[model samples]
Target: MTFSIVARDGDAFGVAVASRFLAVGSVVPNARIGVGAVATQAFARVSLRHELLDALAGGESVETALEQALAADPLREQRQVGLVGCHGARSSTGADCMDWAGGLAGESGDVAYAIQGNILTGPEVVRAMEEAWLTSAGQPLPRRLLGALLAGDAAGGDRRGRQSAALYAVCPGAGYDECGVLADLRVDDHPQAARELARLVELSELYFGGPEDVESLRGDLAEEVQELLDHVGVQGDSVAEALTAWAGEVNLETRLTPAGIDRRVLEELRRTAGR
Candidate 1:
């Protein structure tokens, strides 16, 4: 009924999920900063998301946290879970889950990941996710998770067809306004839910994300920026100031640098000016 990946990359912990269920994101994924991530599906006990986080925050290993969370549940045999903590990764496929239900957990260098699914087309879906996760090591945490998620979908995601998909991740200072949330996006119902979720992830990067590198405003680039600012009716005494105003108006100020702008900002300026 669902397929998901839970992972810890550097200081970030996140989950990407797609399912035939409505609003799978609402019940399948949860994480706490400095704790870990959990995804409970296939007769999901939504409370397990927080229960697993609580156990992990209390210093339990991923395995222990999962075990403790599922210990008392009477329908545990019908529930599936995946977890990735600071220490390691663990996954559970319930005995009573539908055929082709299973999971994989492993480490790629310092990063840990768990991939699981139920009622999938085949085991190849999970395998594709694993391969993508391993090969996408150099990407940002959000992109890495999204890569694996899209791979799984391309490999044939939920057997019942895609209805919802989500990508969520968190790290200190990664979110807008200094919050820990990095990316929290979901396509609640869509024919191409996974791909739609990926599109949302890209938009999130442009809006909520900051720049990786910045270049000083000078010469032609500066002139172009000022022109675009004027075209957009954003007034300022200088190109940088006008750019700042424009970026702020569009909620992209985070990508601005001191006396400079990131490539994303430049591209956005071009877009607003319709060039």
Candidate 2:
């Protein structure tokens, strides 16, 4: 049906997907934090997703982890799977299909990945996947994973045609944080879903505010900080509340400067203005 791997190397998370049919997103995406890997495919094993995450979170190796899991299922051969950890160790499995099938597993400097697909020759798909993975450079893990999938697609992917795609990555931080977003994008149907997903991911990087956003924190009338306070409607005895609200709007670093606006200062200004 579809094949791909979700993996992490330390703080970086990655996802890769490809298929002959349209809309491969649901069957071909996988990811975990402290865990190893997860594989969801035709006759997709939904439980395996969480189970793999549980095993990884418990500090199980990709090998021992998947072993105990597959042991519980007799139809393991008909399934495809792969897992890698921050240490670069890995494991993979593929089964005989009515049609052609193929896959590969490998390690690389604290990072590893597995790739598999059906309705295609095994070596050709794996070869294209490996080559694409090696040639990609300086990009994030998501990009690298997508590159691998694209290579397989070019080499004759699922044999059904193309449709949907997806991407996911995890890192530390809350949802509102710029650096947050462990699992990112999903494009369920389209001719170029992978490319579209990559574009959105890049656009997100552009608009997401971070420490550098301090440069945009200036107030109007050369008193942008004051504008922030006024916008928040803090005056007189309410100056403390206003300053608190303003601090939330502008960077605390710029607001707390020696020339920074603070609660006491806002109160003084409020009294002078007789507001």
Candidate 3:
């Protein structure tokens, strides 16, 4: 009924999942910065999501943690799970899981990934996801993870149909005010949940994205930019102050720097002022 990928990218770890069930995000995915990520489905042993991450945090290898977690569950044969962390990647597909249920794990360079699904169209679903993840080098973790999910959906995910999807990612101090959550997006219910999830990921990048390289505001450029900000109703005694206030209003404080405003922010201010 669901497909997912748990992966480690550089110092970050994340999970992306999709399902024919409503609000799959409420149960299927979990991640922690510097520790690991997990996706528990099939029968959906949600608690195992935390247990697996805790085990990884305790320095257990992916295989050992999965073995112990399965050992503790008398009904292990009905559950499915995927795990990836500092140690590596692993997955489990219980014998009692529905037909077409299975999983795969692989690593390339610094990235390790595990893909799993139950009641899926076939092994092709997992294979396509694996291929996509392996080939998405240099892309951001969320985009890479979401690309894999989209590939699986294209290969025929969840034999039933799409109802919900989610993307959860984390890197050290990546969240708001350095809180740790890099991205946590969910399309709780949508006819095209995977596509909707991709859209949300794009929005997350715009709002929470880091700065890009571009020339800084200085001299006459700074004054002209400040005039634009004032024209947009963003008031301040100075250009930097006005830009900072506008950044806060648009939830883009992360893009500000002592050198100058982000090029993207400056462009946005100009665009809005022109409008």
- lDDT of each model, Cα atoms only? 0.90, 0.59, 0.90
The parts of candidate 2 lying over 4 Å away from their true place are 20-23, 88-91, 174-179, 209-275
Best by TM-score: 1
Cα lDDT for residue 236, model 2? 35
Compute each candidate's TM-score over C-alphas.
Answer: 0.97, 0.68, 0.93
Q: Give the lDDT ranking, best first.
A: 3, 1, 2
Q: Give residue 44's error in model 1 in angstroms.
A: 0.3
lDDT of 2 by residue, 177-255 (tens): 5344544667677776656766766544333322321222234523644554565565433433455455455433223
What TM-score number comes out for model 1? Answer: 0.97
Residue 42, model 3: Cα distance from true site in angstroms: 0.5
Q: How accurate is candidate 1 locally (lDDT)?
A: 0.90
* Candidate 3 segments exceeding 4 Å error: 219-224
Q: In candidate 2, where is summed lDDT lowest over 10 consecutive residues?
A: 208-217
Where does candidate 3 clash, by residue pair?
none
Better of 1 and 2 by TM-score: 1
lDDT of 1 at 222: 81
